[model samples]
Target: MSGIKRTMIILPATLVYFLVMLDSSIISTAIPQITDEFNSLLDVGWYGSAYQLASSAFVPLAGKIYIFFPIKWSFIVFFTVFELGSALCGAAQSSPMLIVGRAIAGLGASGLMNGILTILAAILPPHKLPRVMGLNVALGQVGLACGPLIGGALTEYATWRWCFYINLPVGALVGALLLSLRIPEINTKPPAYEVLHTAMSSMDLFGLVLLWPSAIMFFLALQWGGNQYAWNSAMVIGLFVGAAITSGLFLTWEYHYGDNALLPFSMLRNRVIYSASATMFFFMGVMLTAYYYLPIYFQAVKGDSPLMSGVHILPSIISQVLVTMSTGTLIQRVGYYLPNVLTGTALASIAYGLYSTFSPSTSVGKWIGYQIIGGAGSGATSPGSYIAIQNSVPRAAIPTAMAILILCQNLGSAIFLTVAQSIFSNSLQNHLRTQAPGVDVQAVIQGGARMLRPLVPAQELPSVLQAYSRAIDAVMYLGAGLGVAAFGCAWGLGFKDIRKKGEEGK
Candidate 1:
C-alpha cells in the first residue's frame, strides 16, 4: 500500500486501540463515585480486576480467532461486544452489574490491540512499521495516562456513567470507518462445521478452560493473601495450590497441543521473542505499580481530591505521549531500537528513585519533574516491544507474537497491582502501629484513602499522613526494583534495526 493509504487504515485502527486502553485505567478516578452510588466498598477490587482478569484470560483465544477468521469481521464482532458492555456499564444499577460489564468489555478488548497491530503489519513495510507502531502506542498511552483525568472530570462535572457512555459514539464512528478499509486476508476458512472444529482445536478451548481457572485461582490467591485472609490460611493456600495444579495442567496441555496450542510452544522458543516478553513483563509491572500508587500518594498524602490528583498526574502522561511518538520516529530514522530502550529504562529507574523521595509536603515543581521523568521513560520504551514483534517474526505470525506481548503486559499489570497493594497495605499498617499508636488502624483501612483525614483525630492526623507517604514510598521502591529488572531484560533483545531486513545492530 502507498504511504497515504496505509496511514488512512492506521488512523482508525489506532483510535480503536486508544479507546480500548483508555477504558482500562479511566475507572481509577471514578471508583469513588461508583462505590458511593452502589454502596459497595467491599467490591472495589473487582471493579478494575474483573476487566483485567477476563482480558488476560481470553487473549490467546482472540489471537487464534484472528488467525483463523477474517480480520475485519473478527474486529467488528469484538467491537460490537465491547460496545454492548459499555452500554451495560453506563446503565448499571448495581456494583456487580458494572463488574460484569467491565468483564464483557475486557472480553472484547482482548483482541482489539492484537488485531490493530496485525493490520498495520499487513499494510506497512518493515521500515515504516516502527514509527507508526510508536504512534499507535503513544495514542494508547495517552488514553491510559489521561483516563484518570478524563474520568475524574466526567465524574466531578457530569457523571461517572459518561466515562463509559462516551465510547458509544466513538465506537460507532470507528465501526463505519472499518467498513471501507482494506487489510490482508488469510486463507479461505472451510464451512460452518469446519469453523466449529477450528474453534475446538485451533482455538484450543481446553487450554483456554485450564488457563482461566489457573489465572483466576492465582490472582485470587495474590489478591486475598495478605489482605482478606492471612497468607498462610487454608483459603489462600488452597487457592495457590489450585493455581499451581491448573497451571501445570495448562502447560501440559499446551505442550501436547503442539503448534496449534494457544501459546504455541514452538513459537516461544525463539530467543528474541522470549527475552522481549520478559522485558515487557518487567516494564509493565513498573508502569502499573507507579501509575497506581502515585495517584494514591496524591490523594492520601498530598490531600488532593480525585479530580485534582488526575490533573496533577497530567505532566507524567503528557510527557509519555510525547516521548513514545518521538522514540518510534527516532528508531525509524536511526535504524536501532535498543538505544531508545536503554535510555528509557534508565530514566524510569531514576524516576522511581525520585518518587521514593516524596514526602507529605513535596514541592510542586519537584513532583511535576518526577512525573515527566517517569512518563518519558515509559513512552520511550513502550513501542520497542511492538517493534520487536514485527521485526523478529514472519508477517503470518504477527498476531501470535502480538498476543504473547500483550498477554505479558496484562499479566504484568494484574500481578504487580496485587503485589503493590500488599506492599502499600502492610507498610501502612506497620507505620500506623509505630507512628500513630492511638489511631484506629482497622477503621482507617475500611474508610479508605478519601476517608482517612475525616476518620483520624487532629493530633494523630499528621502522623497518619506521614505514614501514608512513607507507605507509598515503599511501593515506589518496588517500582525501582522492577526498573532494574526491566533494564537487565532489555539487553537480551539482541540489537536490531527494523528498517534493515538483513542487518543486525550492535
Candidate 2:
C-alpha cells in the first residue's frame, strides 16, 4: 500500500473510533437531563452500563464474525447497525427505550473499535505499528475528551436530545469516508462450523458458558453493591457467591475439557500477557472511577450545570488526545513501552494524588493542570498495553488477546466503579450525619440531589454543599491511590521491545 492509501484507510478508521468514544463520554454531560426526563435514578447507571455491557458482551462474537466472513462487509454491516442504534437513542422516549438504544449502539461500537485495530494490524508495518496505533489511541481519546464539551455545548444551547442527535451527521460522514476506502478483501472460506464443531469436539463448552455469566454476575455485583444494596445485604452476598462459583467452574472446565477453549489455558500462563492485562485492570479501574464519578462531582460539588461539568472534563480529554498521539511516535522510536508506561502511570498517580486534595476552594488552574497530568498518564498507558500484547502474541492470537484485554478493561471498570460509588455514598452519608446532627439519613438518601435543593434553607446550603464536595474529593483520593497501584504494575512490566521490521513484510 502506498503512503497515501495507508493515510486514507487510517483516517476513516480513526474517525469511526473517535465517534464511538465521543458518544461514551459525551453522554455523561447529559445524564442529569436524561435522569430528570425519565425520572429514574435507579436506571441512571444503566445508561452508561447499558452501552458498555452490550459492547462487552458481544466482543468475542466479533472475532467469530470476522473469521467467518469478509472484513469489509462485516465493517459495513456493523457500522450501519451501530449508527441506527445511536439514532434510536436520540429518539428514545423512556428509560428502557434509551437503554435499549444504547445497547444497540454498543453492539455496533464493539465491532468498529475491534475492526479498526484488526485493520491496522493488517495494514501498518511492524516498526511503525506503535506510532500508528498511538495515533489511533489519540483519536479515540479525542472523542472521549471532547465528548463532554461537545455534549455539554449541544445540550446547553440546543437540547440534551442533541447529544444523541449529533452522532447522525458525524456517523454519516465517517461512513461516507469509509465507503471510499478500498481495503483488501480476505477470501479465505473459514473451515466450516464443521471445523469449529471438529475443533469443539475437544473444546470446553462449560468454560464458555461460565465465563460470560460469571463476568455479568461479577459486574452486576460491582455496579449494584453500594448503589442498590448495602455492602452486607443478601443481594450483594448472592452476587459475590454466584461470581465466585461460576469463575471456579469456568477454571475447572477449562482444565478438564482442555484442548480448544474460549480462552486457551496456555495464554493465561504467558507472563507478558498476564502482567500487562493486570496493569490494564488497575489502570481501567482508576480510569473508570473518573468516568463514573467526575460528573457527579461537577454537578453536586462544584455547583456546575451538567453541561459545564462536561466542559470542565475537556482538559482531561484534550490532554489524553495530545499526549496519546505523541506516545505512539515515541514508542515507535524507542522500541519499548516501559518508560512511557511507567512515566504515564507515575503522572496519573500524581494527578490522582493531587485530586485527593481537592476542595470547593480549589482553583480552576490547579484542577486543569491535574486533569492534564492524569489524562497524559492514561494516554500513555492505553496504547502500550494493547501494543505490548499485540507485539508479544502471534498474529493469529491477536484477536483472542484483544478480546481478553477489552474484557478485562471493561470488567475492571465495572468493579472499580462499584468500589468508588460505595466510598462516595458512604462518605457523603457520614458527612451529612456529622454536619446536620438530627437530619433523617433515609430522607437525604431517598431525596437524591433534589432533597438538598430547597429543603436546606439558603443560609445552611453552603455547608451541605461543602460536605458533598468533601465526599467527592475523598473518592478522587481513593482513585489516586488506585492509580498508584496501577503505576507500580506498569513499572514492573520491564521494557521489552517486541516489534521487528522483518515481521511486517510477510
Candidate 3:
C-alpha cells in the first residue's frame, strides 16, 4: 500500500481504538456529577464495572466473529453498535439506564479493539507490525491520559451528557472512512448457510453462556457484599455460590471442547501467553485503581474542583504518555520486553506505596513526584506483555491471544475496582461512625466527595475529611500490593527474543 493509503486505513482504526479507551475512564472525573444527578452514589462502582464486564465477556466471541467474517464489515457492525450505545448514554435519564448503555457500548468496544489489531496483522508484515502496534498503544495511552481532562472540561463547562454525546459525530465520520477503505478480506471461507452454521457452532456459544452470568454474579457479590449487604448475608452468599458453580461448569466445557473452545487449551498452555496475560491482569488492576481513585483523592481530600483535579493529575498523565510511546519504540529497537516489564512493575509498586502516604496536608510537589514515578512505570510496562504475547504466538493464533490479553486486562479492572470500592465504602462508613458519631453515613455516601464539605456540620468536617483520607489510603495499599504481584508475574515471562523470528503471514 502507498503511504497515504496506509495512513487512511490506520488512522481511522487508531481513532476508534482511542474512542474505546477514552470511554473506559472518562467517567472518572464525572462520577461526582453523575452521582449527584442520579442520587445513586452507591452505584458508582457499577458504572465502570458494567463496561468492563461486557467488554471482557465478549472478547472471545469477537475473535471468533472476525475469524469467520469479512474484517471490514465486522468492524463496521461493531462501530454501529457502539454509536447506538453512545447515543443511549447521552440521553439516559437515570443511573440504571446509564449503566445499561455503558454495558452496550462495552460489547461493541470489545469487537473494535480486537478487530483493529487483527486488521493490522493482516495488512502489515511481521517486521513492520511492532512499530504499528507500538503507535497504536501510544495512542491508547494518549486517550487514557486525555480522558479525565476532556471529561472534566465537559462536566464543568457543559453537561456530563456531552461526554457520551461527543463520540457520535467523530465515530460516525470514522465509520464512514472505514467503509470507504478497501481492506482485504482475510477470511474467504464459503458463506453458505451450512458453513456459517458450522463456524458459529465452533465459537462455543455454550461457553460464553456459562461465563457471562458467572462473571456478573461474581462482580455483584463483590459490589454488594460490604456496601449493600453483610458479607455473610444470604443474598451475597447465594451470588457467590452461583458464580462458583457456573465458573466450574464453564471451565469443564472449555476443557472438553479443546480447540473449538472460545479460549482454546492450546493457547492457554503456552507459557508466554499465560504469563503475559497474568502480568497484564495485575498491571491493569493497579493502573485503573490509580486512575479512578487519584481524582477522588484530589477532589475529595484536597478540595480541588473537577477541572482542578484533572490539572493535578497531569504529572502522571504526561509521564505515562511519554514513557508509553518511548517504551514501545525501545522494545522494537532492543527486541526484549522482560526488562521493561520488570522496571515498570517495580516503579509502580514503589509509587503506589508512596501514594498510600497521601494526606490532607501532603504537599503538591510530593504528589506530583509520586505520580511521575507511577505513571512512568505503568507506561513502560503497559505494552510489554502485549508485545511479548504477539511475538510468541504464530500469526494464526494472534486473534485468540489478543482476545485473551484483552480479557485479562478488562477482568482485572472489573475485579480490582470492585475490591477497591468495597474497601473504600466499608472503611469510609466505619471511619465516619468512629470519627464523627452523629453524622448520617448514607447521606455522606450519596453526597459523594464533592459535596462532603457542605453536607456535614462544620465542626465534624475535619473528622469526615480524615475518614475519607484514611479510606483512600486503604485503597492505595491494595493497589500497592497488586503492583508488587504484577512484578512477580512479569518474572515468569521467560525470555523469548522476537528479533530472531523469521517473517511469517497468516
Candidate 4:
C-alpha cells in the first residue's frame, strides 16, 4: 500500500477506536440524567457493566473472527453492529432496553478495537509502528478522558440520550471511509467458503464458546462479591468457583489445541506478550478510576455543575494527549519500551497519591499540577505495551496478541471499577454516619453527585460535602495502587529494542 492508503486506513482505525473507548466510560456523566428519565436506579450498574461484560467476554472470539474472515468486510460488520446498538440506546424508552443496547455495542466494540491494532500491524512497517500507534493511543486516551467531558456537556445542554445518538454520524463516517477502502489481509488464507466451512475446526469454537461464559462468570463474581452477596455467600463463592474451574478448563483446552487455540500457548509463553499484557491490566485500572470518579469529585465535593466538572478534567486530558504523541515518537527512536512504562507508572502513582489528599479548600494550582502529571503518566504508558506486543509477535498473530492485551485491560477495568465502587460507597456511608450523624446517608447516596447544598440542612451540608470528598479521595488510592502494580509488571517486560525486527511466524 502507498502512503495515502496507509494514512486512510490509519485515520479511520484511530477514529473508530476513539468512538469505542468513548462509549465505554462516557455513560458516567449521563447516568444522572438517564436514571431520572427512567425513574429507577435499580438497573444503574448494568448500564456500564453490561457493555464491559459483553466486551470482555467476546474479545478473543473477535480476534478469531478477524483471523478467519477477510479484514475489510469483518470490520464493516462490527461497525454496523456497534451503530445499530447506538441507535437502540438512543431510542431506549426503558432502562432494560438501554442495558441491552450497551451489551450489543460492547459485542461490536470487542471486534472494533482489536481490528484497529491488527490492521495497523498488517500495514505498518515495524519501525513506523510505534509512532503511528502512539498517535492512535493518544487520540484514544483523549477520547477516554473526553468522554466524561463530552457526556457532561451533552447531558447538561441536551438530553442524555444524545450521548448515544452522537455515535451515529461519527460511526457512519468511519464505516463509509472503511467501506471505500480495500484493507490488506496480512496472510492469504484458503477461499472464504472453505475458511467458513472449516471455521469450527480452525476457529476453536468450543474454546471460544467456553471463554465468553468464563469471563462473564469471573466478572459477575467481582461485581456481586461484596455488594449483591457476601463474599462468603454461596452465590458469590459459587460464581468464583465456577469461574476458576471454567478458566482452568479453558486453559486446558487451549493447551490441547496448541497453535490454533484462541489463546495460543506458543504466544502465551512469550515474555513480552504476557508481561506487556500484565502492565496493560493494571495500567487500565489506574486510567479508568479517573474516568469513573473525577467527575464526582468536581460535582459532589466542589459543587461544580456537570459542564464545569468536565472542564475541570481538561488539564489531565490535554497533558495526556501531548505526552502520548511524544512518547510514541520517543519509543520509536529509542527502540526500548520499558523505560516509558516505568516512568509513566511512577508519575501516575505519585499523581494519584497527591490526588488522595484533595479537599474542598485545596488550591486550584495543586489539582492542576497533579492532573498534568497523571496525564503524562497515562500518555507514556498507553503506547508502549501495544508496541511491545507488536514488536514481539509475528504479523500473523498480532490479532491474537492484541486480543489478549485487550482482555486483560478490560478485565482489570471491570475488577477495579467494582473495587472502587465498593470502596467509594462504603467510605461515603461510613464517613456520613460518623461526621454527619443526622443526615440521611441513603438519600445522599441516591441523590447522585450534584447540587448537594439544597439536599442537606445548612449546618450538616459541609459535613456531607466533606464525606463525599473523602470517599472520592479513597478511590484515588486504588488508582495509586494500580499504578504501582503496573510499575512492578514492567520488570517482567524485558528491555528489547523494538527496532530489531520480529518473527515472520511462517
RMSD of each: 2.5, 3.1, 1.6, 2.4
- Listed in order, each prediction's TM-score against the native is 0.94, 0.89, 0.97, 0.94
> Model 4, 1-506: lDDT tens per residue?
76898899999999998998889778777775675566533344567767877777778888888888888888888889898999999999988899889989988888898999989988887777888888898888878878888998998998778889999999878888988998999887567898788888788888977787777787677667655677799998888888889889999999999888888888888988889889988988898788778877887788776677888988988888888878988987887888998999999999999999998888999989999999889988888888888887778888999999888887777677767777777778789999999998777766666646767899998889899889889999989999999999988888887776623221
Name the candidate, 1 or 2, with the larger lDDT value.
1
Runs of candidate 4 exceeding 4 Å displacement: 35-45, 502-506
Q: In candidate 2, list every pair of residues with a backbone clash.
A: 145-317
- lDDT for every model? 0.83, 0.73, 0.86, 0.83
Better of 1 and 3 by TM-score: 3
What is the RMSD, in Å, between candidate 1 and the native fold over all Cα? 2.5
Model 3, position 502, has a per-residue lDDT of 28
Q: What is candidate 1's lDDT per residue for 1-506, written digit by digit as tens?
A: 77777778888899998998799878777775575567654455566667777778988988888888888888888889889889999999898899899889988888887889878877776666777788888889888888888987888788989989999999989999888887766444456577786677767898999999999898788777777899999999999999999999999999989999999988889877877888888888777666666766787788777788889999998999888778878888887888888888889999999999999889999999999999999998888877877888887888888888788777777677667767777788899999999998887776767677778999999999999899889989989888888888888777876667723321
Q: RMSD of candidate 4 to the true fold?
A: 2.4
Error of 3 at 129 (Å): 1.5
- Identify the leading candidate in terms of TM-score: 3
Kindly provide the TM-score of model 4 when superposed on the true structure, using C-alpha atoms: 0.94
Who wins the lDDT comparison? 3
What's the distance in Å from true for residue 230, model 3?
A: 0.6
Instruction: Note the clash tally of each candidate.
Output: 0, 1, 0, 0
Tens digits of per-residue lDDT, candidate 3, 102-176, equal 989988988998888887877776766777888898889888877887888888999888889999999979988
1 or 2: which has the higher TM-score? 1
Q: Give per-residue lDDT, candidate 4, residue 321.
A: 83
